[model samples]
Target: MKFVSWNVNGIRAAVKKGFMDYFNEVDADFFCIQESKCQAGQIELDLPGYEQYWNYAERKGYSGTAIFTKHTPLSVKYGVGENDSEEEGRIITLEYEKFYMVTVYTPNTKRDLSRLEGRLQWEDELKAYLKELDEVKPVIYCGDLNVAHTEIDLKNPKTNVGNAGFTDEERGRMTRLLKAGFTDTFRHLYPDTTDRYTWWSYMSKVRERNIGWRIDYFITSDCIVPAIEKAEIHDQVLGSDHCPILLEMKEF
Candidate 1:
């Protein structure tokens, strides 16, 4: 099975930049999107065989997520952790017979780190929620988590430390989550690889220079790691600041 995840930044703008072309080329078993920035009745897709699921934020054109899949999920859920998190439409969980697929757009704490505490709290609650679900079946979690994780996950980590997405507290949250029986597929596959990144700054020539961070991910329960065929960062495809991420796995 093939899975794809991307933070399109905005669905409408992505569409204009050939999202359909990439969507058709991938033909993923499940395709997930974060930062959709759209609400109901805002955009229409012409996908032929995929089922679409969307969670729109109360605030228009802000944070949102969607899932397009060839296979039907047995059950679908929206929002996890605290109820207030639901107001931004940051998460979508789809349960299949064998596993749960979750997509999330983690909150950015801001350059001033004003929202760091709230983001940390959200991570704790989200971890608990994932643990509860893991008791039943494996999980495939993917999206723009908004954190660079470790020093190796980003360019110029020394300078980026304590910045919004590179803060120590944010990285700790990811570390703890992985320790709790989840696997980051990219790192699991390419333990020593370097200079491969997913999200880049839109500033002048930043992307061309590959000055970016590995913020987007395809993570899974530890038990599901054996099934992962390959994990990749699609840095060449660009419609947004973040390029697409790919994960291939055997049928569970």
Candidate 2:
């Protein structure tokens, strides 16, 4: 099975920049996207063999997520809880016979760190939610997690240490989540690979210089590690500030 995840930053904008062209070429078994920034009826994607599932935030043209899967899941769920007040449309879970697939657009702490507290709370809630799902079955969690997990995850970590995505609190949450049973598929395959990144800054010449952060990920239950055939960062593809990451499994 092949899975691909990309932030896209904004789906509509990405489409204009050749999103469909790459989408067709990749032919992923499951294609997950974050920050779609659009509601239902805003856009139409003519993908033939895929079941489309979208979760839109209450606020228009803001945070959202969608999944296009070639295989129809046994069940599909939106959000983390029944009474959960989260309205950003950040999460979607599709349950198959073999495993549960979850795509999340994790909340980001603003550049000024004003949202740091809320972001930390979100991390805790999401971690608990993932653990609950893992108890039932192995989980394939993928999306823009919004954090650079370690020094190697971002260029110039020293300069970015206290930044929104590289803050100690944020990175600690990611570490705890991985320790709880998930494996970052990319790092699992290439532990020492450097200068590989998924999201780049839009500032002048940043992307050209490869000054980026590995914020997007495909994390799976540790048991599924053996089934992972390949995990890659497609830094060459372009459409949004973020590029797509791929994971191929020998079998579910």
Candidate 3:
């Protein structure tokens, strides 16, 4: 089975830039996208074999997520707990027979770190939610998490330290989550891999220089690690500031 995740940045804009072409080419079993920035009735997709599930933010054209899967889920959930987080439409959980698949577009801390407290609070709540789900079955969690977990995750860690996504608070939450029994599939498979990133700044020549951050991820319950066949960063694919990351696994 192949699972793919990407932050389209903006679905409407990406479509014009060949999103459908790449979507058709990959043909993933579970294709999850973040930052969709649109609501139902705003756009239509003619994906013949896939079941589309979308979680749109209350605020128009803001943060949102969607999942297109060939396999229908047994149950679907929009957010973690209360409806407080549902406004941004940041998370979607699909319960399959064997495992739970969750796609999350984590809240960003903003350049000025204004949202750091809220971001951290969300992480705590999210971690608890994942643990609760894990008690029932293993999980396949993927999306643009919006944090660089370690120095190896970004090009200029020293300079980027304490910044929005690289702040100690943000990175520590990721470490704590992993310690709680989840494995970051990509780093687990290729520990030494560098210059391989999922999201890049849209600033001039940044993407071309390969200066980016590996904020997107495919994290799974530690018990599912043995099933992972491949974890890859498709940095070459283009349309948004972020590219797709893939996880191939043996069928459960």
Cα RMSD (angstroms) for every candidate in the order listed: 1.2, 1.1, 1.0
Q: What is the lDDT of residue 245 in candidate 2?
A: 96
- Model 2 lDDT tens row, 32-146: 9999999999999999999999999999999999999999899888878553435899999999998999999998899999999999998998889889989999999999999
Residue lDDT tens for model 3, 149-235: 989899999999899999999999999999999999999999988889998899999999999999999999999899999999999
Better of 1 and 3 by lDDT: 3
lDDT of 2 at 4: 98
Worst window of 10 by summed lDDT in candidate 3: 78-87
Candidate of highest lDDT: 3
As a whole number from 0 to 100, the lDDT of residue 59 in candidate 3 is: 97
What is residue 244's positional error in candidate 1, in angstroms? 0.3
Clashes of 2: 0
Q: Candidate 1: list runs displaced more than 4 Å.
A: 81-85
The C-alpha stretches of model 2 lying farther than 4 A from their native spots are 83-85
Residue 173 lDDT (model 3): 99
Per-residue lDDT tens digits for candidate 1, residues 148-251, read 98888998999988899988899999999999999999999888788999998889999999999999999999997999998989899989999999999997
Candidate 3 matches the true fold with a TM-score of 0.98
RMSD of 2: 1.1
